[model samples]
Target: MPRKPTNIIYSANEKPPAGTVLILGVQHATLALLFIVYPLVAAAEAGLSFDDTQLFITSCIIFMGIATLLECLPRPGAGMLLVQIPNMAHMPLAVQSLAAGGPALYAGMSLVAAISQLTLSRFMRALRAVFPPEVCGVAVTMLGVALADPALRRVFGISGAITPDLDLRYALVSSVTLVIIVGLAIFSRGMLRLFAVAIGAAIGWILAAYLGVAPEPNASFATLPYIDIPHLGWPGVSFFSWALIPAAIITGVLSAVDMVGTVVSMQRMDDADWRRADLDQAGRAIQANCLGDIGTAITGGFASASSSAAVGVAFATGTTAWRVGAVSGILIILAAFSPRLIGVLTIIPSPVIGAILIYAAAFLTVAGMELILSRRLSDRRIFTVGLAILTGLAVAILPGLVGLTPEWAQPILESPLSISTAVAIVLNLVFRIGIRQEASREVTTADNPFTVATEFLEYQGDLWGARRDVISMAIPVVAEGVEMLLDTGVAPGKLEVRAHFDEENFDVALLYEGEPITIPDHRPSPEDLLGDAHAVARFVGYMLSKRADRLVLGTDGTREKLTLRFEH
Candidate 1:
């Protein structure tokens, strides 16, 4: 079923008021700070100096703003209003690279990764057959699962902290923060709801300060320089890492999934007429994202990503204005020079960031599941999705158990996410999966309409045991209907054919994005369709009038659906 359309206060393409843009920009900036956990934690684990950490994180923030700006600006392939931040998915990989080879190793490897991802995006349209929504959904769900433990651990100050204990004070701060965020998001009206995360962080910060959280920022806030920029050097590749190329390629694919999901989610949120994804736009967005990563590496930050947090902020605020993100990017760039502001920003406790992560993880997990369920859930889908998610979770909790995999493969298998995504894709190919899935088919312009329509009806027609003459008759009618539709200037790829059968009713529905098409009660005369002296075309016109028991054209507010019912 199609989702009922709702009015959007600020769409992706449209610009809201300057005040509205400013409001959303600040909100988005707050959402972005959560991702700082990536570089900061990775830096700490790698034992980098305060100066090295600042330079690295500053690079991330600066390039993040640059990436966000490119993503927002009007371009042939890029969508508007997209927000880019430090991607948490790449945190582990980054930490590994940074710890092993310092910022240089991380930067060089990140450039290669982005290039690989850019290559993938160019060919994304071709690979849709292999990685359909079901496969992608499993991959996406696994990502959320793989990321959960780290976030949940931080909620109690277990990860990246001085006290890795279940201290009640930490728990209270995190829980209260989570409660406030969830409360405002669910119950509050207007802008208050949009700013929930920021508000929750403020409350959590104040609470943590009062309780004297152990990991306080050591940088003296009052005496911090009014403005400062760290001296930076160019990144050089270190031979400290193994499997750099394969790691870049495989992880790049995972990033592609993240890119596609973010684009689709934003489209669904903003566009009333979103039936099919704009693959070109998605590919372009990936290109922009790739540029961000490369820029981050060259400039000094770790690789960047399109954060689920940004998407959540867009959805929550009902503001998908590109200017908002662009302005936010500007603010981010300006902050890189402000030492006092950086110290204050860093002071937000880990638990608060953890609470934010919890919300994003939950949102992304549910969104992935919804994408799969939106179409149909087959037994294979259930198994594939379940297996992938469970495998990821298991690996996260028990990495030692996966130690049997060869050392060479460990780079890919070390994380449940990488393992599960690889597993799902392989299983999907082996099963020709979408197994036991619904009989719906996507309409693509690459195939001839007449051939597609004939095969579609005949395949379903045979199972129903419809008379050969009836099956034969119905095929041409469908072909003619489709050809006629094509001639009317409707893009072939925008149309879909979905067939459903019951004990008594055999229904073939044509779903397309266009003005509603009317199938008239009167049959077309042979002369009318015999243009160019085509016999088949003439016959089709005559048969189309009498084939189906009922032909009804209706609108789903966004697209027109034509249902053809044949009496069995």
Candidate 2:
């Protein structure tokens, strides 16, 4: 098993105290509820009746709760502390569906989107190569980048028409909230850091209320029942249309891609030794997310996706226990029945939520940059990452370009997460055109043997996208092994070096017309270490054995082969 990250207070399998779990669960549920505003936006756009909108929100929350629970389980889930919420990205298409055919059309289109996600999830394992580290990095980075507009808009009170005084109050509240969260996460220890976001949000809410910046509940709040059972808002049958199918399918694919990045972020948070994404696990996560969307669809709710910003919250708060996520799921499901709880959560100051999102975005952006540099970079990879970023940014910086895309493609082209991910995957494949997984070169005493071997391995490592540590370890061990072979007269003539990488292991084989050098089972004694040429050669052989994870001595036809194998 890989090491748990030191910053993570609780891992996926570990259980926190019930009290702590409940507290954290409430925190997550509160965050997830904030996204319910998206469904409300669609409801208003479609001009639904108040009761219809209420039913839609209730059903969405219930399914999001169910999906959140599934996401905490290992079999159908990505098994991380992930929260599912209404997907704002799908809001436009959902509105079109709602306007054209009412709740039934919206539910049907959402089901199609769910099926689309399910289809993509099945092939996630096979598509690993298409989502290399840098590509995944771009997706994760854009997840953060996509949050920037909403976060800043809320922080500055620019999302709504506001007086200058109100805008300043929003800024003040958001800044204070952000500072408390960041300062606690950075400077405090133990429980303070564990509840950084919760504490910050609490303080921000209080300040907002004091300043009259927090939303005031209307007289309708007094008439709303404290608890009400949730029911399906529309009939269960799926509605389908050739015209809407493209939008639905594209929405599903984009959600799947978004889930991929979100799962990767969660994986990185839990494991200190995170190498690459566990796409198999990620596939299961996508499946879980799709299941949630399916529930929402059948219930006449909106489409849903895993929340990337919530992962940032987990990272910032230092807790990612599945127990906490499961607890949050329960609360969310219960909140669907509790109008009072929903009412209280709904009034949370937008600036406060914006501060929390800003905090998450900061962490995710930096984490994505680190992930991008985790592997050796070649010129091809540099362009793949650089150009993908530019393409994704263009969508954000130039909103008019979304209008240029066909209606079917607009859903994908409009979002930074989808556009950057598509560009990165395509560019990565395009750049791999001439790059081979295996390479070979000849080295001899006539040439600078070490330099020849070093350059060959470095180039191949970059081309094959080998782990940096693996390549770094391989270079020196191969160099020393070659010197030992020639010095000990095991291979005095020219040699052939062949390198191969399969993402899991890196193998370098040296073929020569000589006998195999003996690697001692134990470390060489002081006498042997200080002894003549042969003792020195034996000592080098022993050290080489220690360097590589496995050292193989074998023969290929008439020539003897020495191979160094490193686990990536």
Q: Best candidate per lDDT, number? A: 2
Clashing pairs in 1: none
Q: Provide the TM-score for each candidate, comma-separated.
A: 0.73, 0.95
The TM-score measured for candidate 2 stands at 0.95
lDDT of 2 by residue, 291-319 (tens): 88887888778777788778878987789
Residue 2 of model 1, lDDT score = 31
* TM-score of model number 1: 0.73
Provide the overall lDDT of each model, using Cα atoms, as 2-decimal numbers: 0.69, 0.86
Model 2 lDDT, full chain set: 0.86
